[model samples]
Target chain A: MDIDTLSEKIVAGDRRALSRAITLIESSRADHRDQAAQLMERLKGAGRQAIRIGLSGTPGVGKSTFIESFGKMLTGQGLRVAVLAVDPSSARSGGSILGDKTRMEELSRDPNAFIRPSPSQSHLGGVARRTREAVAVCEAAGFDVVLIETVGVGQSETVVAEMSDLFILLIAPAGGDELQGVKRGIMEIADIILINKADGDLKPAATRTCSDYSGALRLLRKRPQDPQGFPKAMMVSALERDGLQKSWEEMTALTEWRKENGHFASRREAQARYWFEQEVRQGLLAKLDTPSAREAMQSFAAKVAEGGITPTVAAQELLQGLRD
Target chain B: MDIDTLSEKIVAGDRRALSRAITLIESSRADHRDQAAQLMERLKGAGRQAIRIGLSGTPGVGKSTFIESFGKMLTGQGLRVAVLAVDPSSARSGGSILGDKTRMEELSRDPNAFIRPSPSQSHLGGVARRTREAVAVCEAAGFDVVLIETVGVGQSETVVAEMSDLFILLIAPAGGDELQGVKRGIMEIADIILINKADGDLKPAATRTCSDYSGALRLLRKRPQDPQGFPKAMMVSALERDGLQKSWEEMTALTEWRKENGHFASRREAQARYWFEQEVRQGLLAKLDTPSAREAMQSFAAKVAEGGITPTVAAQELLQGLRD
Candidate 1:
């Protein structure tokens, strides 16, 4: 199908068209890139927006369970929900985190819900870029909420946070030592810290962990976008379906406050500008991806390692060669 | 003043020539850059080596005090020392952290010690690049050790760590809350953690803080380059000049082990390649610094912020315009 038809179908809330558009965006083929660009351009006129909540947690932190419960709650309230995962490690692990729909079986079967796994064969930057585009496609398809999930490791959280309006970090119940395991950078970006598995024997532990993180978050530098007493921690039990409503309320309250304070629109504008600059930087780096350029870089790297030339001088020579 | 003469003078340990070479490297002028490149190329033949140690700590963490005592000890042992500071905030703060040599007055007056403050007018990347080149000049000038100090805030620590053989993190004596204040990313890169002020009333507190960090360090993932029990935390009192020798001993032992195990050369090679790639990336980005390019970026950013175009589409349009 052409760009116009695909975009029209997407705007009409056709699930298959949205999926196809996402697949096109994830494609590395030259022609597919052109089509994806045109499709995105066509969808721009839709001007649909969604509550983008970026969620991240370590493996076994109950992300799938939490998303299923939380997403179901949104759908039950007569809202359309879309889930997109950004798993950079899937390229090396041979298994995407959300590749198995059974992990969120109930939500998968819900008519109001759509779930998409990560593209399993791209670098982190490419995956993030594609996921951001997929989010746009979802919004154009009239989704009320777009949940972006990423593994809470390395730089992926920062990348996910950039495309998201609100970033939620999920963690298991543990002591202060476990708190040390959390990346400081991730903590700085998170708007909320949710202690999952707050049911049965884990309730007290989860509560304590929640309070610990609340204290930790208080110590972090305050962001201008957040109102007073924000970036707080809450306890949730995905299995028991407890605290989901409260968490949702907190999210909505934060969203409403941001919207009222002008932060909502300004935050989106900043995110858009950030992505634009990122794309430009990536495009510039792409210039060095050719076979000859690779060969030249390899040769120069060897000389630099051998101490035959200073790194700056070697880079200047290579850049000069490129110019010539 | 010529490249050949400057290189000769630097190699002979002429302090004025070394200072002049660093000034040239730090210069943003087109002609100065060319001359700096030639001078660097000439100095590559000097083949001298220095122990490049990068140290960082928050303000009031006794960095100046520690460096003064440490530099004096090194000079007393008949080793020439060069100290370079990288302070990205100096541009806006109107005062470089090390601009006041009185902070290290004794070291400043010591004939065997050389101290240079931050450039005070460049971005982090430019400051880092210049400081790195200055390190090379110091090495060529027969300095036995080059110490790079950066304020332990923001991204400067990572930049300094990239150019150093070992990274040391300095902190004040405090409890677990203070531990939380340390950036996790900086902790991951640190080779040693020193809890300063281990004298007088703070002795016990300093010792406890050291043990706390020691436990924390154990929980971090083991690095392949480190031997067992490495990346440890220790207590130091810069005022009393205690623990300085032990810290130096550990640094030398780590450096020796790395050299014997081949990590030393490999790390430097990796650093050289890193710098070369950074220079290439920065050179590519410099293309957008033109007035017309800036205006174009502004217009596209406005469109992206306005929701009139997708960020990816706007970036593509701008990139296409560049190509045309």
Candidate 2:
């Protein structure tokens, strides 16, 4: 239970200890948090060796299948692979499918591969707190490659991008008009574009779709820093296992290039800084529940509704009320 | 400038007075807002007769063109139309394109049509405020139909649906995979699905896409609490004027049906209630900027970052600190 003992167990590659450590950190419990902090401090120098890659797509883009194929490929080459699949929690249940293990059964059964799925719980930050904590756990467990699979290319996926060394965006063969509707917010965040399900009768259409996307992508200005590559597009098929190796190779190449070029380290540092700021914002917002603050808010709102004043003015009045 | 005088002029079809009143309400200036409140009270019963329609799509869906064509159709039939197009504010400039009038030259020139583009400012609710106020202005100026075109159909579009009686979702003829990626959140909100750009070589593809969407849509359960005759789908072209009449007919049918069933009046009442609630939330959050709250927040955050506490615990500590 002590930090040093738990840290040793985790570093010795005990999966249970690693999982428990993540849970402790993720818990809102006071004592567990103290234990988690102590554990993270002891294991501070234990992580940071894994190649973290974030993969995202709209649902049904074969995200699970793609991870399975890519995991199998990595393990086949004698690389230790760990996957953290982040599923947004069901709004009704506040729980995830937690089906990544079943979806990646072969790799899950492999002694060299580990898979974990974390529920988002409606939090927009990419990778659940448990999942990010689990990545450090995985790294401490000596996994060389950590794959973070997130659902959709929205706020949740952007979280993955922040924590990842490489970010992959997956799409299908979309019609011209459909492609145009793709939000620039997501597109701007994407580092690599993969058009999945590019096999069978849809091959020609997929090819056309790829060309169309590639053409549109070209019109998008490059990242102010990158001179050569700006979200390179490729065609792949998770079912057919086609282009899986090629995509993996490209990912590895990008990681290596970024790491060597200083972008990787700097990117990780930036992510760490962002994580800190966001945590503070979330923390402060959660604190406005004091009795006087809450009381003043209620009275002010009642008055505003009674047509005594406007919202902006009422807000200022409430703040002054709090001060008194 | 008095409420009674302004109200009389607005009802007498004074366009400038209506525009100025809306601008005043949307203004943050304290005096302007007080005047706006007076204006709101006076005009409360004057602008409820217009048919409010919400149109949303991902960007590049030719939203402006569609609105222009739809406005033209209404004006051609001697019906007055007003459009409020919401444009995304560029983060860099903190300004919007506000180009709806430019894009809608034909409709703008028409005597019976009015077009206004509101900037999506720092506050999501602010954009919405301007929009609702603009709609009231149009209604007071005798426009029978008020069309609200959203900035885009991701998260922001949800606000538009809260104000409009009818919600129309525009999508392109998507192939199989992209179809799966469309958020079910969007589908659930859509009262009518309009497949835009169904023309030329895309005609057959569009028809096939329509069938696919129709089939997929059938799998969804009937929306609870929604009136019957919701979720109609049709193909349309803003450029070619294809299916424009059918789309308009559906809107009219829904409006008439809702009016007959008493849902129309209730919907407007619900919208006003919802707007007040949203304003309260924004107003209360603004109170969190008080110096005492800010200081307590910083100190608690330091504790969280130092690993002596968790965010939730830190939150409680801040609230407790406020009491001191």
Kindly report which residue stretches of model 1 are placed more than 4 angstroms away from their true locations once superposed: none
Cα RMSD for candidates in order:
1.7, 7.1
In lDDT terms, how accurate is model 2?
0.71
The residue-by-residue lDDT of candidate 1 on B1-324, one tens digit each, is: 679998999899898998899889889999998999888888878888999999999989899999999999999999999999989898788778663589999999999999999876657888888899999999999999999999866888988999999999999998756777787888899999999999999998998899889998998999989998899999999999999999999999999999999999999999999998888888878878779889999999999898888778788888888878
Model 1, A1-324: lDDT tens per residue?
888899999999888998899999989999999899888888878978899999999999999999999999999999999999989888888878663589999999999999999987657888888999999889989999999998866778888899898999999999766787797888888898999999999899998899889988998888998999899999999999999999999999999999999999999999999999999878878878879888999999889988899888898889888878
DockQ of each: 0.77, 0.09
lDDT of 1 at A79: 96
List fnat, each candidate.
0.78, 0.04
Count clashing residue pairs in model 1. Answer: 0
- DockQ, candidate 1, vs. native dimer: 0.77
Query: What are the Cα lDDT values of the candidates?
Result: 0.90, 0.71
Q: What is the number of backbone collisions in each predicted candidate, taken in the order shown?
A: 0, 1
